[model samples]
Target: MAVTIEILIIILLIILNGLFSMAEFALVSARRIRLQQMLDRGEKGADIALSLSEDPNTFLSTIQIGITLVGILAGAFGGAAIAKELEGTFTVIPEIAPYAGIISLFVVVLIITYFTLVFGEIIPKRIGLVYPEQIAVKAAGSIVIISRIFGPINKMASLTTDAVLWLFNSHAPQDPVVTEEDITSLLEEGTQAGVFNEAEQELVQSAFKFGDREVTTLMAPRPDVVFLDLEDSFEENKEKILTSGHTRYPVCRGGLDSVIGVVSVRDLWSQMTAGEKPDLTLLIQEALVIPEHITALRLLELFRTATTPLAVIMDEYGSVAGIITLHDLLEAIVGDLSTVDEPDEEPGIIEREDGSWFIDGMLPAEELRLLLELEILPGENEGVYRTAAGFVMSELGKIPIPGDHFVLNGIRFEVADMDKRRIDKIIVSKIRHRGDENPDEKTDNHTTS
Candidate 1:
């Protein structure tokens, strides 16, 4: 009967140790955000879980003390009581009687250790991990009460631990959390594992890259931008507006540099339908001016708050560099919109039959780099110049004429066509050589024909 009581006590101590271990693991692993959400939904005990999570050190210390005390008591009382009980059982054999006490003690210790390791530690920890929120909430109140009862001892232990850590120039281990890179890597792995489709993966990756893109990278270049000259007559402006088919046009007094405001074609259409001539001054709306170096993500916010669809990008000298629309800003996130109606219109890159590429000069350098599969372009000043034309001009240090060609980094760039002084089209072809490709290789070959 005494042996039975001792075994029951030992089992109870093991259960108590398991409870403390479960509480410690569950509370530490529970997500605070998840707890808050549960609280918002009026889930019972979520608030208690949150309270315990907030002051983790004290509650964790309480659990540690409980586990330690339970373990020590179980070891001492279990071994002694079981040994006393087994000593009587071992008296049946006279030969075994000599070593029976030691053998009984060993057997008792083994049984206690096995139960403590499996039931007290592994099973409880596994349960806590699998159902952290549920277990954490259940264990929170009990742990908090225990912590309060041993508040002084917990404080002393914490202070002593801190002092010892400070003396050794060490700190407590922080909770392991996922980082941005880890999330990105997980997203990539998910894509490979069929968890995320291609379009979904692209959207997520685009979102991550959205903030890194500057306004200049997405804006229509100055050469491609269609604007109205304030000095022009109503008929001239009306003709340009009809031919261009653009809804919004920048009103520049003198040239592209002297942009005053933006004018909407809707306002012009209203005036024309009202029997009044389309007036540039009256149709113009306030233009939202943003620095060229601003990010596309920030531009989206500015557009949202300003309630403007059109914004003029200005350089450091306050000159109009280019223009960006709401559609342009969104393209950074969703990628290029399909132009199904305009099939004849040339894309940024046109592949030829001879494995060469005819690229638009205004195509973004980053896009061109991807198409060409080149690590670095000739002259890619990340902020200053973002387009292919700008990159070419930067490399040559002058406006390139038609038929001017140069080779750099195993790729050959030839001016296919030029619109006045501006580069309009370029021919990109890969140069395959046995040895190192010469960067100074220049040719007057216009490869378009």
Candidate 2:
């Protein structure tokens, strides 16, 4: 072949190699969520891109085949055909004439390799990775056509791969899925990029975890529940309602276990404001009963269908476990919402002046982890326990009594108070060590309690 034709063919091969490199990297880097979004908008070739990305064997085999062929042809043909032409040019210098063939072959290989690496691999793959979804959509049609052409060969390659894996009693791993960590990292990255504020990023992260969290973690456990008794006179129940300052009261005849209905303070106050007698019985409405094990997200949906936001969470034993509200679910998503019912003095977590903490027994483990700066809490994955009290019970393997304490992750949890068998108040302090560690967080549960 002529030197000009040989050079042109090598250039064409490099361009083909670049195309294959771009397609392979773009498909690999393209996120399924972004591709699905593009498809939802009815963008042309998006569906094909999504399909090609989802089937790695087809598109991958096709790209590998194209790249392999391009490399072979470029190396083999450029050396035999173009190296002779280069030798003729090198022979012009008589001093190097005898060594022209050797010099020409080395020069040809070096130039081709350099161009192939830069234009064919690095640059194209960088472009692909930087704008993966967009490039995937744009190249989707061409890639699909190539995949179709190589379908039989692709199938054979897949079978060979599977057979090798079968020898090891293993199969190829499935493609990656979007995980909580992936979304969390994205949210944090957005925060760093100024796309979302820190609070907004936290809200999104919490919302993502909403479905995975059970009601038990977020509920006001039975110990903290303030109820009205039907056996008590209206004046007695009124005192309880005014003292607790809660919006709704579970109206129980016997106890929390025998909750008959819920009564709203608004109803009683509305009648009183209208200069009419407040009748507690007339204001009572049946509370929605839900299993304690149900997710907070599912309960959020359930609230949408109910007449009132209040619900009684029943344990597997059919006894009332706790009470929850739509407000509770919203607070879980958006952080604490202070209401007329919630007294400012009684926050769930309180940092003492001594740097120790006064955390309520009902506080969720997730929130505790954030407050304590701990990596994880025990039994979080298994749903074995949800609250700080539950954590204490699990660690101790019994109902903890007042003054009982334990240390974990350098934090000492002391059972400061107990309401019957249930934990009511916890004194959380750092276990300080006399060392180079930060003075505040180190040595005997540092609070001189």
The model with the greatest TM-score is 2
Q: What TM-score goes with each of the models?
A: 0.70, 0.82
lDDT of 1: 0.81
What local distance difference test score does each model get?
Answer: 0.81, 0.84
Worst-scoring 10-residue span by lDDT in model 1: 440-449
- Candidate 2: where are CA atoms >4 Å away? 40-42, 79-100, 147-152, 169-181, 273-275, 316-318, 345-347, 350-358, 369-384, 397-403, 409-411, 416-449
Question: On residues 1-449, what C-alpha lDDT tens digit does candidate 2 reach at each position?
Answer: 47788888888999999988998899999999999999999999899999987788778878888888887887678666788877899899999999999999999899999999999999999999999999999988997787788888878987787788799988656646887888899988999999999999988888987888888887777877899988888899888987888888899986889988898888888989999876778888978999988899899888888878999999989888899899889988888787878786477898999888998888888888888887777786777788887887777677877878766656777889988898889988886775523444433332222
Please give the lDDT score for candidate 2.
0.84
* Residue pairs in collision within model 2: 432-442, 432-443, 433-443
> What root-mean-square deviation over C-alphas does model 2 reach?
4.5
Best by lDDT: 2
